[model samples]
Target: MFIQFLKENRYVSMLLTLLRFYLGWQWLTAGWGKISSGKFDASGFMYGAVKNMSGEHPAVQPWWGNFLKEVALPYVDFFNVIVPWGEFLVGLGLILGIFTSFSILMGLTMNFAYMFSGTTSTNPLMVLLGMFILVAGINAGKIGLDRWTIPFLRRLLFKKTEKEQFPQSA
Candidate 1:
């Protein structure tokens, strides 16, 4: 019942639109800040995360810390490029309601990654809100571009018109 309401309710959709805007702005600002700074470095952060695995009840888990040290540190340059741009793109997607599900998923991925690195900040809240948007599915983007894009894509990909899918009553 609750899930159906979330998925189909017009009022809930409006609330989701507001939530999307808020999250989009948060991501856009954070990404823009990093991009404009021209000195966003992940190596230091990686080192800190790796070091965090040492203490008892370490903030960062050993597996994640190892991944950070071994994979991420070696590819710090890649992270440097992808992190800011990924955030920016996710924000843009969410705001535009194009690829809304993908945007939320990417945002959640980043949020989890940050949390794993021991940086809580606003990540938890973002994750909670993001989950709501994700669960809402297509309804979350109904007021945005997905209203058209999804249907167009469905027609293009499935090669089925709505009339065929739902025959009109004579």
Candidate 2:
């Protein structure tokens, strides 16, 4: 019910777009700063994430801790490139609405990743906004590039081919 309303309503969608833009801007600036500074390495952060793991009310999950210890920590160089570029791309997608839903999904995934690493900060709020945007569906992107790109991509990917597959008698 509420989802339907959010999806179908123009004003609601506009509001959602604003939120989307905000998230996009956030990602863009963060990534751009990293790229420009040439010092946005994730190695130190990853090390700290592992070191921060504690008892009882631990911030980081043990499973994530294991992954960090086993995979991420050993591959700081790889993560350094991936993180900044990933943030930049996500921000571009969200801002342009070229792949709005997919962009939001990616953002949500990153939020989860950050949270799992024990860094809360704005992740919770971003996740909430991302969820709402996801719930709003195409409406969230009706005002942006997705409005055209999505339909075009859909037709390109799923066009009816029965007529082309078989000759119909006139």
Candidate 3:
């Protein structure tokens, strides 16, 4: 039934596009603020975060945490420096619509981390937003740089694919 609605309403596509762009812009702006504030600090913070998260969820702790603890934490400064930049890049990617799907997934990954860390309330909005972005797929690129960049991006990322054209609905 919902599928029929999705098929019938052309505005559903527009809603999805607007939602993705707005959410992406919001995320990018927030992350950019953090980066520009010059107070970015994730050293022991992220390590502690990752450890606490793993300890809290014993059943789901990936083996990679051990590697993160051993190899990654040793260079805490590097992680601290990069985390905000990574956030900014992912946010920029989404906001700019460069890699809409991948950026949405990255945003979801970060949101999931926050959600799992006993911060579900604040994360819910973004999490739902991520879900919508994912369900909407690549059709959410009309009002962003992705519309112009995706052609070049497709050549670089999906050079062998013939299905990299823009959506008909747009």
lDDT of 2: 0.87
Residue pairs clashing in model 2 are none
Residue-by-residue lDDT tens digits, candidate 2, 98-133 = 788888898898899898887889999999998988
Per-residue C-alpha lDDT of model 3 across residues 9-105, encoded as one tens digit per residue: 5677678667776776767776788789988665555465456545545422455456556666788678666666767777787766677778888
Give candidate 1 regions above 4 Å deviation: 160-170
| Model 2 spans with C-alpha error above 4 angstroms | 162-170
- Top model by lDDT, which number? 1
lDDT of each residue in 1-170, candidate 1, tens digit only? 88889899999999999999999989988898899999999899989889998887999999999999889999999999999999998898889988898899999999999999989999999999999999999999998999999999997898967799899999
Tally clashes: model 3. Answer: 0
Score residue 32 of candidate 3 by CA lDDT.
81
TM-scores for every predicted model:
0.92, 0.92, 0.66
Candidates in descending lDDT order: 1, 2, 3
Cα lDDT computed for each candidate against the true fold: 0.93, 0.87, 0.66
